[model samples]
Target: MDVFRLHFDIDGGSFASAGNASVEVKKTLRQLGVSNAVIRRCSIAMYEGEINMVIHADGGTADVEVYPDRIVMVLEDHGPGIPDVELAMKEGYSTATEQIHNMGFGAGMGLPNMKRSSDDLKIETKVGVGTKITMVVRL
Candidate 1:
């Protein structure tokens, strides 16, 4: 069994740079010979999280740990925090402003998509403090 770890900082308030970390991770996974399906699932979930960080929070940190049997990703941010985690997890329920929606984002699918793609997902958020999300995928 082997383990590989990776880290990235998501820049806040930059739509253009959002999801870049996930893109890099995807490339790294490909180079590491990870399966396409697994890589795709991870990338999709990570990308969504990255976008959320940019849109909702003022950027965040992404940590990925790859093990022989599974992969885990942790995303942490110190933003306004989620007022209602359950509501935030709903699809098509957005708290974004008109500007974000105008940019083709804030469709409110990030958390839901992340849950769907990962084998396990955990979210810790404090109102007015921040949020931390951990997602795991089986290999």
Candidate 2:
């Protein structure tokens, strides 16, 4: 299989459109004949990252690279960076506001879900700056 690449601009503060990018990525993977397990992993991880982008950052961009053996995803945002990576990675840890909680998120599961779905994950952030997360799933 050849490498396929895609990009998405996540809308900030928009719960209505949080999973759009992940949906599109799922479609792309289906079209590319990716395996069900691979697609599911990618979709789950990407959706969590997308939700995080909307909740924390005003908006951000996602870059997806699909290769024969693995899929790579990079989600970057300009929101306030995570103060503590360890705390943020906790399953029940979240800094989301009440407004976001009302929208069915902020359960503090996004990061943990992402970690669970991906074979590898990396997060880079600077307080008051932004965050960038990279995830990979083996095919």
Candidate 3:
């Protein structure tokens, strides 16, 4: 099949709509006949990235490319960049505010879950600038 692409504008600070992009991507993968396991992995990774963007950044853009052999998800945001990726990658480490914690959304598991769910993960960030995360799931 030819490559299929999807784009979404994530509304930052909108917890109510946080997982919309991932849900749409999941639906599209199912329609494309992607395997359940692959779809689940992609969905989980995408959802985590989307949540991070909503909680940390003001908003962001998510682009997904579905290929015959793999699905690529790229999430980019203009929020404050991660200071220490290594620390952030560790489970249970987060900088979310108390309000975020009270919302039951920030457990510092976003990056870790994204890493676990994707076949490959790449992160690019600049302090005070923004962050870009790329994740791939084999199909």
Best-fitting candidate, scored by lDDT: 3
**What lDDT is obtained when candidate 1 is compared to the true structure?**
0.92
Candidate 1, residues 26-139, lDDT tens digits: the string is: 998898888999999999999999999998898999999988888899999999889889998999999989999999988888899999999999999998899999999898
Alpha-carbon RMSD to native, per candidate? 0.9, 0.9, 0.7
State candidate 2's TM-score: 0.96
Worst 10 residues of 3 by lDDT: 100-109
Clashing pairs in 3: none
Model 1 misplaced stretches (Cα beyond 4 Å): none
lDDT of 2 by residue, 63-138 (tens): 9999888899999999999999999999999899998899788999999999999999999999999999999999
Per-residue alpha-carbon lDDT of model 3 for 1-115, expressed as tens digits?
6899999999996899999999999999999999999989998999999999998889899999998888999999999999999999999999999999998977989999999
Ranking by lDDT: 3, 2, 1
- Cα lDDT, all candidates: 0.92, 0.93, 0.94
Off by over 4 Å in 3: none
lDDT of model 1, residue 109: 89
